[model samples]
Structures are given as C-alpha cells and as structure tokens.
Target: MKVSIDTDRCRGFGVCVSLCPEVFTLTDYGYSEVSVDEVPADLEGAVSEAIAACPEHAIETL
Candidate 1:
C-alpha cells in the first residue's frame, strides 16, 4: 500500500511519526509527511495504526 498525507489537513501532530517512523516523518515545519512511496509488508500494520490515530485524518492510502 502507498500512503500520502494531506498537508492542508495536518495539524503537526506526531501520532503518525510515533506509530510509523519508517513511513511517516515530521517535517521541519512540524507537519507530518510520508517518507516512503510504498508501505512495506512488515510496516503496513504500523502505518494503519498511524492512519487511524491521526487526529486530523490527514493520512490516506493511495
């Protein structure tokens, strides 16, 4: 699965980063961004958690 973060909807929350450091990261400005183009099988669960935990609902599978 591929994931993308909607920056406009992001609130600089660190939930995604905390849940899936391998795929999601906090930008220099503090918003969350996707670091990987595709989600690895081993990390898909973590990414799903991040998506569900994101308060802004900014993360989505593409």
Candidate 2:
C-alpha cells in the first residue's frame, strides 16, 4: 500500500510518528510527513495504526 500525508492539514502532533516512525516522520518544521512512498507489507499494520491514531486524519492511502 502507498501512503501520503496532507501537510496542509497536519498539526504536527507526532501521533503518526510515534505510532509508526518507519512510515512517518516529523519534518524540520515539526509537521508529520510520509517517510516512504510505497509502504512495505511488514509495516502496513503500523501504518494503519498511525492512520487511525492521527487526530487530524491527515494520512491517506494512495
């Protein structure tokens, strides 16, 4: 699965990063960004958790 983050909607809460640092990361400005273009199968569960945990609902599958 492919995942992307909506920077404009992101609040930099780091929930995604905290839940799945392998797929999400905090930018220099502190916003959460997608660290990978195509997510690996092993990390899909964490990615799903990150998506569900995101208060802003900024993460999406592509």
Top TM-score prediction, candidate number: 1
Error of 1 at 8 (Å): 0.9
Q: Candidate 2 — number of clashing residue pairs?
A: 0
Clashing pairs in 1: none
lDDT of each: 0.90, 0.90
What is the per-residue lDDT of model 1 for residues 1-62, given as tens digits with 9 covering 90 to 100?
A: 99998888999979999988999888889988888877999999999999899998999898
Off by over 4 Å in 2: none
Model 1 global lDDT (CA atoms, 0 to 1): 0.90
Question: How does residue 28 of candidate 2 score in lDDT?
Answer: 94
How much is the lDDT of residue 40 in candidate 1? 93
Expressed as tens digits, the lDDT of each residue in 1-62 for candidate 2 is 99888878899999989888888889899998887878999999999998898999999899
Query: What is candidate 1's TM-score against the reference?
Result: 0.96
